[model samples]
Target chain A: MEIREIIISLFYLIASFLFIFGIKRLSSPATARMGNIYSAIGMLIAVVATLLNKNIVSFEYILLGIVVGSAIGAYMALKVAMTDMPQMVGLLNGFGGGASAFVALSEFYQKIGPDVAPDIKAAVAISISLLIGSVTFTGSLIAFGKLQGIVTGKVVKFPLQNQLNILLILALITLIVLAVIYPQEQIYYLTIIGISLLVGVLLVLPIGGADMPVAISLLNSYSGMAAAATGFVIDNNMLIIAGSLVGASGIILTNIMCKAMNRSLMNVLLGGWDNTASSSAVSGGKDVVIKSVDSEEAASIFDAASSVIVVPGYGMAVAQAQHAVKELMDVLEKRGISVKFAVHPVAGRMPGHMNILLAESNVPYDKLYALEDINDDFKTTDVSLVIGANDVVNPAARSNPESPIYGMPILNVDYSRTVIVVKRSMAAGYAGIDNDLFGLDNTFMYFGDAKDAITKLNNELKNM
Target chain B: MSDLFFMVYVFVLAGFVGFELINKVPPTLHTPLMSGSNAISGITIVGALVASGALHATEHATLATVLGVFAVAFATINVVGGYLVTDRMLKMFKKKK
Candidate 1:
């Protein structure tokens, strides 16, 4: 190898080590920010090293693309609201996937000729890259649309939906085979791309908004796999190592999300809440008694309590109530009341979503506890203040086997001495099933928007 | 064949390292972890750079250049946007005095 090649390889090796160390630092909150910076630096080194490659003959296009892409990316990073993070991540995932697909397409175009074709291995790698990359690109975009309200969040189903998806997969496999056998044929490659794109849409369309976290996680994994496939086509070790790392991280996250909801990967992929009909029927048959409380009454209940645990959900996100909830925490703590937050694994649209929102509100990280760490604490707590959360804190998940969400782990807010639930109305949650926590004997429903309710409750607490 | 075998060895070992490192990340940092790793996956930008800048003496050279430019741009967005967003989120996590 030439001296330049050796230097570039050494830089890549250092970057890979930095990537590993950066992720290792993520195990603690204190060092996580620095960890992200470390990874960014590693990326910079890798990009610079690649630019030194002898094969690159020009610099104008690279410069233009970097400048334009960086400008748009910085704007998005600065302007997006914290509540819209899930969709933002999903959009970026799509971009990464799309780039991988383009790389494969470019390679294919460069290699194709009248009497020449790519090797069998290159052909196979290109096909896999195109297939996975297209699916991740379109699927992530669909997920983003659902979260951003550009598309309906409801499960979109059609006649023969499953059958059509099956047929598409079969056709995609056949096309992939044909493309590999006749690497010179562009028609087969294009057909495979088309089918894969359609399959991406179909794969995500049936998944309801609540299951978006899982879908996004899975798609994130696919994007990495696509990048790795591209690495194989290009025979680049840097891309392979980085891609596999991301692929593994995404898989672990997907599994964590699936386990949080007590569902299999296949179940989430096949479209969640399959028993909605029977479960809703079972929950709606009984008219349970519920007690309502105003902010004044709720404030008094909180005032008397010594400890409170706040449970936040997607509704809190919709109401943009994290700041207000933070204000409530301040008021409570000022009165010598200890306040902590209990976050269910599947509380919001994405994993760790609620924690980020809470963090944005300037709540201390140490005060937020995961479900397992604080689930039993509710039994001794004075007040469990549920903010715009329903299914996650619903008691049915524990006590009722007939409920659709029966097996899912939930925050045991119902066990608190006084359970205060703030919500807009008695509407069913994303699962379309009644939350029995609202009707529990110790529970007091505070009906209003989370921000408005929390603000009013804060006022009452302050005036007292 | 030996080169391919070596690549597979690197892939498998790197995957294991990724799994071990990521499993240690607390649940609170899961979002940042996702976005951070997502940024790393943008390493495919290396391929895009070569595709766009490498001089090709072929009938499809222009087409390859156009596609490569787009890939570079898109991958740049993924890397830049993902890392910055993750940093923004991670900055919010703080411990009380």
Candidate 2:
């Protein structure tokens, strides 16, 4: 009703508009960078408006928090390698969730009084915030640790893993109901927080590193839901709108990742690869024949090729081979060979991860094609150069029903006229299944690290 | 009750808008989209600012301030680090002639 309150409300409205506009611009690469800047400006306006609120009585702590946080954030933004992006994003998601929990906690503390019972609505909101926020906080940290190699990347499953998660959910619901009935009872709220944290860890711990993309995406969604819950606790529309927007984006990405792997969301969440043993057993018994090639020999194939498609995987990331791959593309392109990158949806640790790495190497955005767009082209292509990718390009996903990765969509590099795979050895991919593509008659294995092998091949090409 | 209904309305509408907009983003920009949206979720910093600054002379004032300060710092990191990292990634996507 007051003039000042109306002004702040109007500012929030404008900020929301900017956020919507920014995300809309992100639909195209040409405008995506500017979109990010637009969102940042919106954030600035919201923060300033919040500072202007009459409820805020002090500034010292706020200033201190901002300065310290900004320093660390700037350092991480500048220092993180492109390959470690999944981990960085996971860590950031954890912080956002943790912050939401903390905000809810502070709100609870402010209202804590022996004689005073919080309103039922506020109580429910606070409890929801604590539960979702704590879960996202701890869940994202575990996901981060898995990707950062601080925790084992293997699928760590215990007996009754899914049952235990279900039990935890049941308990959380009971606790939430208790908190609502006895709004003054801090015990119920605190217990909810603890159990939620435990559930977060347990939920993510069983997921293997290969499935971290989906986990991170899901956790990203949780973080937004947490923020929205905090918004409900604080009765802030800006938080609600922004949080829901993020929640929706994360869900869309998670769905895309699950579809790419041909798995359901619940299957991924319940810890995939339960049939790894049986599937690998089926493929392991056979000694498939493979044709090996040296860098010079591979170069000759490239020299004769008119069109080439490059399929990059996590191995390419581990070898830091994006730049080298870019170099190879250049050499091939110079010889009048058309070179394009075929990036599978689940190609790297996260969604669109391979694209980011390739982009970092100055690969033209227009030249990098998604799986669907380039899958058919491989059939007519002269040489399909696979760089450190295994499961994604494996033919087993299509032809073998007994394989663990069966039915998953894969790049049809096996259909190319000549399939050239650059890898360290015959090691299986993250799924631990043998790749039938490697043994195909048209496929030639170029052994070595992705970077070293690509560099050598470039040398051979230049000398010729 | 009316206010609650209003907030719910806004939340549902915003979610729909998000879905429509995100569905349009090319797979090429998915990573940036994730990080950028992650930064926007840091809008909780507004709540954190109020929590930290609106301290009264209550018994739990110190405790609340500590929690608020941590919340502000964490949310700030999400916003600043997320946006900066996203920009770093987006800057790499170039079109060659």
Candidate 3:
């Protein structure tokens, strides 16, 4: 082996190790940033090694790609609000799939002559990469659009959507087989690519906004597999290793995300189109209507409370109230009042969303409590300060079987002696359903920006 | 290391890099996803597959071809299996309430 080759291989080994460590670190919401940095370095190493290799024809394109990619990446890192992270992820997944698809198409373009080898091996690999990559690219883009609210995520459920998708997939497969046999038929592959791209749009079309995260994760996994298939096409070792790594990781993430909501993967994918709530499930929905509390009144609740449990939800994320909340927590703690964070299993849209937001504000890890740990305490607690929270604290999940969120666990904040809900309005969560917790007798709504409310409360407490 | 190996390395390395980007995103379920992906990334058995068929100096061309076919089959299984499981997991989150 050449010296450079040895160096590159060593780079691969080292990079792979970082990926392992980075992934391990990511398991905790705390070290996830460091994990990401390590993985980034590993990728940098791998890219450098690939550039060192002889057959790239033009390394300058790789450099050009890097300059463009890094600029976009850095801008996203700096400019993207934490609230837009899911949409950003969806867009990035699209780029990955598109890149892989382009690479496969380029390879096919280069080898389309009459004498291009009978090497069905290369043909099959490239075809698989192209098909999945094109589909992933389009599907991920659609998911991003929906997440960003640029497009509605309403189910455009047609008369035969599933059947159409199956037919499209089969047609693409058949075209690939014909392309493999003909070897010179460029049109067949092009047709397959076009059809696959359409199929991608169709895949995400029926999926609504609520499931965008899952759609994004699944597309991320597809992008990984597409890369792996490209690895096979070109006989590239790094491609296989790196692609499989991502492909596998994306899959695992998708599953855990699913479980967090207490739904089977199949139920999430195929069963969520129909309305999850029925009218009978919610009785006298306003039996315990909560009146919105102002800053001064909310202050009184804070001052009187012996213990305050802050239950964060997606609304807090939208308002970026984490730091303000953290500041409020410190003030309460200093005042000899107990402050604990109640984090539900499926709080926010994803797993550990609350933890990440709080961690970003440098909240103490010890102050955080999972739903089960904090649920019982709320019954006796003086005040449950639900910040921009919704479905996670709903009582319907606990009692209403016909409800969409039935069987899904909640924060049980209703049990608290006094429940203060902070939100902009009575808008539902990502599930687009109303929360019954707002109607509880013990609950009081605080209508306004969560950060502003917290700030007002802090000022009032300081005066006291 | 031949050019072939270098290309493969780049492909896989890109994989790891993307992994970091995704990992760093402030998603709710990084750990379980990480654990799940680690189990799937172990399917890099695709490397072993190619190695088995590509390095046989004494074998006839036909035998080499057969081994190559098997290698492709095994690697494809790894690819298909890995992707399918990941797809299934992602689909799990679609039922958001």
Candidate 4:
């Protein structure tokens, strides 16, 4: 009935609109900055609305909460390097889960009397929040540990890990039953949280370092659901809606991200046979020796090529060589030669790794195609330029039964008449496996920074 | 029934339809999107918001209050950081077609 309440509510509406617009702009890497602004404005609105609410037990703590949170966030946004984004994400995700579970537990304890309606609702909200929150928290910390190399990123499959995890799941189910029947039962509450935490750890153990990005996305989705569940318990329509939107979008992102890597959800969640074999891929003996080439000598091939396909990988991103690579593409295109970029499903630190690199260089979208679409075409191509790509292009995926990426699809760069691999060294990819294609007869290894190598290739091509 | 579950429903479906916008979105924005979403996903603060006064006996209330502070603090970090990062990332593009 209050005018200010209505106005505050409208403000949230505006914020929601901004969120939509932000997500839309985010559709294009070019427009992503705008999207962030829109979403932030929406959040700003939501915050102001929360402050405006009459139900607050106190204001100082709330304001303090806002100030402290924003300070750290601002630093991360401005100070953290782009390469460290995954780690930053893991840390932030862990914090989110921690917050949600805390809220749920607090609410449950603060309102457990049979007479208080608010406490009852709070108790219910925190229960679900605690369950999902614990999972997100531990899972993200493990992801961070893996990325930071604090823990071995190899899939940790302890004996009976699966069976132990199943028992934890059963314990969680029992706790849920107790929560519904007894409602205020504290023992059930604590046990549920513990089981959930265990579930989180177990869930991520089998996933190798290669799948960190997908796991991060999935945990992010879980965090959102935890938030939305909290919103529902509180009867906060805006929180529920916003939480759900993020939850939904995060899941979509994880799935899309996984597909780009040609990984299935079941495989990722269950930590199946696909990634567990990562240990074997790390050879005890230097199994295959690979030869390397300097930029100058490699340039000769580029100068003579009629058609070239640039295959991108994580190295291109780590070195930030998109512009230089694009320069190479431009010159090659001008010389009456066809230049197309071949993107592997699971290239770079995450999915869309190659696409991101190319998009940054302002490469046209039409010029890029997935491995399946372009593999057949590689055989007819005059030259294949492999730029820092590793696992995605590994021929082992095609023939080796013992290889980890086997049965998984790959880019057919080997089929090309001439294959040029540009890498710093003949080191293994993220999967830590030796690339057999590195020593193949048709493959010429161009050893240097991808940007420098591509730029030199451009220089040599122009001279011709 | 509530909008939260419905939104979750949308996200779940979107998760499966991962093929759609991902291919459509470019790398220029993917990093920003990832960080932004990570930040937004911090909305888990709602848990603490409800926890502030949600306990039974006086002892339970005291415990809930202590935990509630952390819940709110953590959620605040997630929401504020998520929104601002996403916004800042989006703001880099001053012009739109």
lDDT of each: 0.89, 0.91, 0.64, 0.69
- On residues A253-328, what C-alpha lDDT tens digit does candidate 1 reach at each position? 8999898888898888777886447644767777779999999999999989999999999999999999999999
TM-score for candidate 2, residues paired by index? 0.98
* Backbone clashes in model 1, listed as residue pairs: none
Better of 2 and 3 by TM-score: 2
lDDT of 3 by residue, A1-464 (tens): 98987887788788777766766655554464555556556655665565566543333333343444445544553465556656655665665666566556555654555455336866777788779878987987888788777778675567876787789878987998998897677688778789989988888877766565566667768867876776777565656766777786677567756765667766666635356554434544444456887888888888888888999877788778888998898889888999888886555544555665676676766677876677789888889998877766778778877677777777778888899988887766755666877777788888888888888888888888
lDDT of 4 at A321: 86
Docking class of 4: acceptable
Candidate 4 local lDDT, A1-464, one digit each (tens): 79977987788667656765666667864567666777767766776666566665665555566567778776775675544566666778788888878777776666565564334445556577789889988888888788777878776777887688777887887777677677767787888898888788778767787777688778777776776676656566555555665676667768766665556887776664443455445332445555666667777777677888888877887788888887887887787789888886567655454664465466776688777678889989888988888888888878886776676778889999889898888667766677878878888888888778777777776777
Looking at model 2 chain A, which ten-residue stretch has the lowest summed lDDT? A273-282
lDDT of 2 by residue, B27-84 (tens): 9999999999999988999999998989655567788889999999999999999999
> Model 1, stretches more than 4 Å misplaced?
A275-280
Worst lDDT 10-window in candidate 2 chain B: B55-64
Fnat of every candidate, listed in order: 0.82, 0.85, 0.09, 0.43
Q: What TM-scores do the predictions have?
A: 0.98, 0.98, 0.78, 0.82
What order do you get sorting by lDDT, best first? 2, 1, 4, 3
lDDT of 2 by residue, A1-464 (tens): 89989999999988998889999989999999999999999999999999989989889999998988899888998999999999999999999999999999888888877666668888989999999999999999999999989998988888887788889999999999999899878899999999999999998998988898899899889889888888899999888999999999999999999999999998888878765475447576777899999998999999999999999999999899999999998999999999999999998899899999999999999999998899999889999999988989988889888887889999999888999999999987888778888878999999999999999999999999
Error of 2 at B86 (Å): 0.9
